[model samples]
Target: MTSPDVLDSYAPVVAEWYSANARDLPWRRAGTTPWGVLVSEVMLQQTPVVRVAPAWHEWLARWPTPAALAADQPGEAIRAWGRLGYPRRALRLHECAVAITERHGGVVPSVLDELLALPGVGTYTARAVAAFAYGQRHPVVDTNVRRVAARAVLGEPDAGPTTTAADLTLVESLLPLEPPLAALVSAALMELGAVVCVARTPRCGVCPLAERCRWLISGAPAPVGPTRRPQTYAGTDRQVRGKLLAVLRESHGPVAKDALDAVWGDQVQRERALAGLLEDGLVVTPAPGIYALP
Candidate 1:
């Protein structure tokens, strides 16, 4: 565990760096609501900021509030999801909106437990919304934040594959006593991880914490594991599913089974992908041979 003094020393440096270097993400804008923050967190999962920005703007323009989104069919949400990929997140957002509207009186809940209870809001997301949206003091640990913590505080090359209870405890311990300042530190740590302490190629030359970073002081050793290759998208089941969903999203009504078949050549793969989409509730068979977004 990093000593309290060292951890305390890290916050201001990282937070100052973030103040100057953080991206101008729309969700981080001064007047963005809790609903907007929640939406951004969901869209950012396994997706990049560039793709998410326009989609997020369009989504909020169409459905400004949870009540506004809840008033519409789930298909509209999926349709507006565009090519952001992982269309199920659209469904989950729709469900989350409905829950927020019905249970929380159309307001995004500020409580961490309440946020977690919403559809598709996991640990990272719950803490993110609580800290970023509500400005509550919560350790908002994501992949970037985890990596920063591992390398900077623990003197490791990288974090474990999954976040552990120890990770949360360590991060929480680093937070400042003030709720708002702690939130700022959390955001700063995340920003540093994203832009400076990135996984493949860290820009340590420009990092604010370089002098004090444990990994840098110890020679920044290479991670001891086989390098993982990026997954290919072409000709995969994921590609087929995206194609099928595209057809459905473009259509105002149910699409014929033949329409989906035209997108992918492999019948087995196409069928499997379509079946997976149906199972995931990203698509619905409104008629015997026609599929539509649900």
Candidate 2:
């Protein structure tokens, strides 16, 4: 790992690079409301920024704040989550809105623990919302930040397949004081990892972290390798679940199982997927064999 003195040199450069090259994503702008930040972070959980932007705008415009969403039906929220792949996030968001209204007086909680208590708010999301929305000094380690931290600070070729609590602490140590600056630096590291210090083809020649990177100094090694390719959607249970859920989402009342059966013909696999969704609480069997969104 690079010593703190060496690591310090790269910070200014990263901050500069971020300021100049960061994408003009709506949620990153100054004066963005906390609710806007919360919505963007949630939409971005398993979805890409490019796809989340328009949906974020629509959600915020319609709901504007937690109370607005709290008052609306969950069906509207699910439908508003158009083409985001994982529609469950919309439902969780609706739950979060209700929680915020009842528990936090309709305001996004600034404290990390309070944020974590919200529905669908995991460790990464909690820290992200705290740091990004409230400008708090917390480790906001997403996949991008993890990759950057491993390479730049530890000289590692790649981060582990999943996050650990230690990873959070290490990243937190790198953060400077002044909450806004800390937030910016966390974003800077992520941006560096995303665009320049990429997974497959790192642009080390132009990378600001090059001078201090342990990986570069050690002669970057090949990564340990991904454990698996992305889970395939084709003919998978997720596809079947999406199909079944789509029908119920479109219809107001309970949908006959026959209509859902028509979506995916594989009787055995289709039944398994539907059962899984029901078990996951994403679907409800209103009556005997009739399904609807929960």
Candidate 3:
């Protein structure tokens, strides 16, 4: 077997491993509609799978299609979002629903460019939808994919924070030619990264790539990048934003300014957080002294 053959050998083993080990994600079900996949992908963007699971089910139950979500008020969407932290994504997802209903005739677009043009769809997300929804062969490189490829293939302990154009090419070249196989392979690689090739403590023993890992051969050098920490929510803008949104989410319409002030004790910080949400279009001041979820 040649070098390409050697590289390609990993696919079958990975797919086999995936068959037995893959988590029973609803979106991965045989008859899962594209709308369900899109919803799962959007909700999974920055939130963890554990948090997204129930929300995903509840959301699909309420609005199984884009046209249905598009018909709902943004206020309801925010309330449904329920402390997801990044509330802006909720607004953008609502806009995406409206755009999909209007432009794509309520169908999730399969073309990468078409998906990219939709609001809130970024490079990773666009490719993910195209490949997963339509059986297209495109590299779906999220943080997990990047990290796994970096360590197992490129000999890098960690992928840098930013995804470069070259990173996409590197991952794309490894994808199988067959569309469905390629899609399965992409998900398998992501699963490997998330579960086995973890950031803090990689489980090399169970990893399919353990024997072939470049990082293992290179003696596992430290990451040549800035380290990060779990973000502190207390006294941060995120906490304040959560506080402000909670008030608006509970209210039917515009909440009195004084009512919002009751959520956070610090008057100045609460005001700033409300202003930030308004600037981000997550909230609107329907009246002079009242706030509401936008």
Candidate 4:
């Protein structure tokens, strides 16, 4: 665990740096509603900001509120998602909107527990909306925040593969007492980790926490284990899934199963991918031989 002294020292510096350096993302702008922030968080799960920006704008324009989205068919959401990589997230967002409309009267809930109770809104996302959207004093820990904490506070080269209860506690200890200030600090820490204390190649020279960073003071040791390899996309089941989804998204109505089969040559692999999509609720079979996005 990081000492209280260290935690106190880190917050103001990072928050000040973020005030001057944070990206001009639309969701971060003032007056962005809770729904907009929620949409940005969901779209940013595995997709890059560059890709998510235009898509997010389009999605909000088409369905500006939870009620608007809930009224539309889920398939339209999937179609609008448009190569965001994880189609499941699109379905999850659709379901989330439906729940938000029905449960909260079309308003995005500000409380953490209420956000979590909504479909597809996990711990990280819930905290994010509560802090960023509502300006509550919660630790919004994501991969970036975790990595920043591990290196600056723990002297580790990087964070663990997944976030744990300990990670949340460690980050929460770093927040300021004031709710709005603490939210600013949380966003700052995330921004520092993302653009400065990045994985593989940290730009320590420009990092606000560089002078006090434990990893830097300790001579920046490398990670202990073998490095992880980048994920492959070609010829994988994910690739097959994308191909199948593309065919479905392009069509206005249900497509023939044979049309989907024509996408990939490996019939077995193709069939398995289609079945996975069906099971995931991203695809629906309206009839014996027809397939479509849902």
Candidate 5:
């Protein structure tokens, strides 16, 4: 059983550390709408802050509300995504906006289930929006938070590959009863993991919970087993997909199949990549052998 005292101890220190050290992200600022929070969470997936910030600013400025985005073409969203790597998120966000506009009357729903029902919204995103945007009490378990909990409470060097029901339960146990405080603590835990207690090299000296951390007490054992290698983008199908999409994004209308062929040399790999893009709905066939953004 998780101890209440141990969980309670994390609240004050995490909150204090966050107050002093948290990054001034636009979505975290006061008066940020639920729609803004929703966009940020989606964009942050597998993408870094340095790239997300400007794109986010331009996105919100162009489509400030669910209604605004819903009114635009999904192709526009894809075009505006602008080197964020995963273009599928653009399509999903556009669909989410349409859902919000139609179902929730242009407001981002506060209900967890409603948020989850939207296109591309999963468990983590649903909880994140509810906690961060609506000030609801929820256990927003991301990779960063899971790592923090693993090292600080479980005395483990890292969390497993994916979050589980057990992870949510542990996070719930650590949350404060008050919704606002719980939200702050949730954000603080994520921030702590992102900056101080990072995966590769943790800065234990600057960490607020270093003294109380169980992994630290256990001699900060090095990770066991083979480290997973980062996925390479160069010469991969993903690169071909990006190149194909870039052509469509820059073009005013449907691009000929021949135009796409010029972007990649290997016909087999290039065709596979373009087919994948079409399958993902990031590209659409406006006419025979002519591809355009959806």
Candidate 6:
């Protein structure tokens, strides 16, 4: 039942709002390299913007191009990753740099399929790079964009569990005709969802779409049943893995199993966590019972 006119108005209105209100992220700045956009996307996956800002600056300074990163060891990527959480992303990014070097002559590929072929690049990332980095008109749907589309267009409190094909179709339907403007609209939608139409306690009074939002017109009903569960980190294998990785990252050379063993008290949980890291290719067994980053 979503009106076509209302959806059509989204790009222009949100684009204007974003021009005045978008955050001053480095990656959004003019002349930022495609590699910068790629790195920022990977870092921003599960981490917050406030934390990502400095790390992003440092990362680009150290390895400004894929060629620079591809020249270094993968372990150096992990070391420079610096408490970003999900250190595996660092390894994947390293592999992505290598792929770019070998496959695309060290430049971030502009074509969506070529970008998607890089290690750890997913649909969202591929489309984001194509649209944001290359000025190609592709829908860049993330959690934030999905939520914005759901509430503003569908009158829903939240989006589905994850971005689906329908999500891409919905956003693409709203995009402007011109490629550059379409990219702008995509960024604007993400910014709106991130800041104004946030998951909890959205500040609708400040929202650009407050007057036309479907969810707002529908009384903004609370989500039905129990809300989605939040992820826990304490006492989990993830925490154990993080602790072990921190030890390895701080060390210049391979860390003995005893050193890793001392990081977590529970032998079973620690072993499980270490095994997971090894299986993930984040950690390598340089020798029997000796661990180092790959």
Instruction: Give per-candidate clash totals.
Output: 0, 1, 0, 0, 0, 0
For candidate 2, the clash count comes to: 1
Candidate 5 lDDT, tens digit per residue, 37-78? Answer: 999999998799889999999999999999999999999999
Winner on lDDT (4 vs 6): 6
Which residue ranges in model 4 land beyond 4 Å of their true spot? none
Looking at model 5, residue 287 earns an lDDT score of 88
lDDT of each: 0.92, 0.86, 0.85, 0.92, 0.93, 0.92
Regions of model 5 farther than 4 Å from truth? none
Cα displacement (angstroms), candidate 3, residue 183, comes to 0.7
Residues 1-294, model 4: lDDT tens digits: 556887899999998899899999988988888899999999989688999999999999999999999999999999999988898888989999999998899999998899999888998999999999999999899999999999999999999988899999999999999999999999899889889998979999999999999999999999998878779989999999999999999999999988999999999999999999999999999899998877
Could you estimate the TM-score for every candidate?
0.97, 0.93, 0.94, 0.97, 0.97, 0.97
115-197: candidate 1 lDDT, tens digit per residue: 99999999999999999998899999899999998998999999988888999998998888899999999999988988889
- Output the better candidate (1/4) by TM-score: 4
lDDT of 6 at 169: 91
Q: Judge candidate 4 against the unseen true structure and give its global Cα lDDT, from 0 to 1.
A: 0.92
Q: Top model by lDDT, which number?
A: 5
* Pairs with backbone N, CA or C atoms under 3 Å apart (clashes), candidate 1: none
Q: Write down the RMSD of candidate 5 (Cα, Å).
A: 1.2
Steric clash pairs (candidate 2)? 155-215
